[model samples]
Target: MPNLLDIELLRTFLTITETGSFTRAAEEVHRTQSAVSMQMKKLEEMIGRPLFERGARSVTLTPDGFRLLDYAQRIVSLSEEAAAVFSEPELQGQVTLGVPDDYADRLLPRVLQAFARSHPHVELVVRCEGSSSLGERIEKGELDLAIVTKCDVGEGEVIRREALNFVGAREHATHLADPLPLAAGPQTCSWRRSAQHALESVGRKYRVAYTSSSAAPLISAVLAGLAITILPESAVRPEMRVLTERDGYPALPPCDIGFLRARHARSAIHDALAHHIVTRIGNLSPAVLADAAE
Candidate 1:
């Protein structure tokens, strides 16, 4: 008989590859790092090849690992689709979801509340993090679904994408001698990266005055005049000064917002929730674009 490959182990492998950190992968799967490591070892032995190259503080998928990723994603997606078609009765299952911190504050609460009201028996677990982190969690099956900025969606399916804009203090002058002082999130934030690149593309020098993964701290930094930051228009408050013109400063390029669902585990609750977010966000797009135009 051919060597058997466990679907669960493959799912774990995919998570480890996407996160590039065993520790984070373990956290996503709700397993200890050691256990995750052991599962990988078992998987490698069963396959007769190492899937990832291990280092002291980092990990990367080997060619074999990359090859497995495509299959893993497909298998997981098919499994979910099968469950969706065959499962009976109303959807009732635990759904672990990931959302970017900024969206969590401005948009997610309403979506979750609505979902809870509609699916009263479903348990909802939410994790708020940067887009990159959320992507990793979603890939690993740690999250049943995710709302995040567009980044590496991997070979997994994409549900929807929205454009993001740069938002700053309304009263701040556009002309600055130094690199624009920026209040931003950690390095993994897509908005922060977009802001820096936009400035650099225009030959503008900018410094990060504040960096925090949390939206509250980043927004506080912006409000305190420590620095201006890029944010989605939906996240901007009416009280703050905003720059809508592109005269002195670089034009903030649009970033994509993506909603994703795990291919492997199909949950009707997650599908419904994803649909809800896409619909709500679509309804808000015109306003978001209008704000950016200002």
Candidate 2:
């Protein structure tokens, strides 16, 4: 008999590769650096091959690591799919889920597809709104579950923490404008505030060249080279370029993603969906995994 690869280990492996830093991946997965290293050692032992060429500051994948990456990604995704498929087969109810526009495209599909496949009888009522609005909705007992941003010190259970960065079109010099042209959201948006604060801290003059409540349009504005905007590092697209300190863009605070559940009631369906959201989104995202494989 052969050793079957562990999905959990594979997930951790993916995290290490995605971050390229054991310490960083450990923090991402809420584990100690030593623990993460041990896990990787275990994975390497199972494969009978070294996975990483460990350097002082970062780690690069070995050829075997690259080969395992493809398998790990598929195995982890399929494992999630399998879990979702077999989860709460008897539960039948409705769950109203609220998500902000930014994460709808990046994070929703897995939840939607898995929930739909796993619990077909349960209706997942999804609402697209800003995090502030979503938080208000949860408090008002209008939403059963919500993925919202946590800007303040402490409030909700944070599921994901992502790097916030200044992003512009790949070929654009919009960031170099005299009063740097910025494409951002309304005053209430956390990301917008982060960008503003980062710029203000450095006394960088900037003007709002474009404003949109939705992330999709703001992304469009950046792609068109109209302006630069703040985005999650993982969410940056191929057409976009991250503006670093060399480009005079100050680093913004990391974005915190929190999950909310309505106080109205707690049913089996609600708990199941909530668990699903936390598990899927709490870990390194599929986007990071794809980038690692690339």
Candidate 3:
């Protein structure tokens, strides 16, 4: 039999091609730059061609590189599809789930509790992080499923898209001078962008009064009157008030929260969990569903 090409090396090659830098690809794959280079070298030797043109400051794919990339992507995608179809067993084992911090606190607990009550034998492992981080973990196969906000779809199944709304403390003064102070999350957060766009569309200037990756601090800042924040209605607690809608602030376009799974994951439990989330949380806003249909 001929020497078989390594799937891992192909994956590394694809990552390098997509990111356009070996250093960034190494960071993404959690390998050293030298290790990534070695993988590329091994792949080139196997294929009997140099795939990339190495320059002093930059690297670009050669003509051969483009051809190999097409094949590599197809191979990886087919491999994942095959794995998903053939490897998945009946639901009876653990399922690792990732959820955004706000969702975990406000909406997920009930869904999880219900799932636990029904499927006591299946262990559920939950990871809480920002939506972007959650999506990254799911893509890397570190997580089975994730609930995220407005992630670039790229090429994957989108399980659901929930609507997000602007929220604020009911007691805070509705009126503010130019450049409204906005409480926000890290730059990667989808809601942060929505808040900024909402303000800008209405000809309102804004400044970031506070920034945190975690949900607790962001909520605290809102409660303390430091600044207003935008969140999904499902994430809003009973105590929080709708300052924007009440004060006649123009409504922001609804944020789309989505659930995603690895294309290659082999677990019936993942399917079941995804079905549960989409049916339950996805249906929370009839208005959103109607709008999407329209």
Candidate 4:
């Protein structure tokens, strides 16, 4: 029989790639540097190719490593899914989840889908609002859980920090307008605040030409060349163009996205849901995994 690839080795490989250093990866995996080194050696032997371009201070993925990464992630996800199917009992209860308007179309589906698969009996009630409003709801004990974005220091477990970008339509020149047109959400939105502050800091003139609380209208505004909006890097679509420093858009600070649990928690069901959410979403990316783990 051929040598089988190990899931642990794959995880370590991903950690190393994400952290950009073997030392950090070792810390993440709770292993010594030498042990991590040996695991990579064995993984390379199993694949019969060099996975990393080892350097004095850092290591980078070789083409073979890059190719294998996708497969490894899929395999690990499937393995975890299979284990979870039998290991976790069918749970029953209601969970009220709050998310920002921007992430409803992107992050919510994955979280709800994973919960549905493992805890079919649990009822999920979802509410969409701005991050600040969502945090308030969590504090008021109206929501069981929330994923919120914060401008400065965020509360709760930060899963990732995504850079903000000025996005415009792919073929549109709306960003070229004098006193650059901006499409923004409500005044309370952190992203909007960050965008305005960044422009002010750079002495750039901008006006809120379009305003919408929902993503569709904002996207439409950008597509029609009416205005450009600030969005997290992950939210940038192929139909959109990301305007950088060269495009005269000032660099905006990264947004801290985190999971906030209600202060007055209730049952085991909520705990299970929280654990499931953290694990499943954490696995989505290396950066998220590292942060969620911490």
Best lDDT among the predictions, by candidate number: 2
Give lDDT tens digits, candidate 3, residues 1-294.
666778899999877766667888888899988889889899999989897777666677777887787677667654654564455543478888888787788768756865664556788999988777777787788988877775533434444455566666766752353567777887766678777777778787788888998888888877776677877777787767865655756676665667788776656677767755664455321111110000
- Per-candidate TM equals 0.59, 0.71, 0.60, 0.76
Candidate 1 clashes: the total is: 10
lDDT (tens digit, per residue) of candidate 1 on 1-294 = 868788889888766655656777788899988899789899989889987665554456677777777677666644654464456355687888788778777777767765665566778888888777777776777777787776634433343444455555555553342767788877866677777887777787888888987788877766766677777666878756555445456666564567777776565676667755654453321111110100
Let me know the TM-score candidate 3 reaches against the reference structure.
Answer: 0.60
- Which residue pairs in model 2 clash with each other? none
lDDT of 2 at 211: 89
Candidate 1's C-alpha runs over 4 A off are 1-90, 152-163, 170-177, 283-294
Per-residue CA lDDT of candidate 2, range 221-250, in tens? 899888899888657889988999998888
* C-alpha RMSD by candidate, in order: 16.2, 7.9, 16.0, 5.1
Error of 4 at 53 (Å): 8.4
> Model 4: clashing residue pairs?
none
Give the local distance difference test score of model 2: 0.80
Model 4 per-residue lDDT tens digits across residues 81-179: 668779867778788988876877776777788778877888999998877778888888999988877552257887656778999999988888889
Best by TM-score: 4
Clashes of 4: 0
User: On lDDT, who's better, 2 or 4?
Assistant: 2
Ranking by lDDT: 2, 4, 3, 1
Whichever of 1 and 3 has more lDDT, that candidate is: 3
Sorted on TM-score, best first, the list reads 4, 2, 3, 1
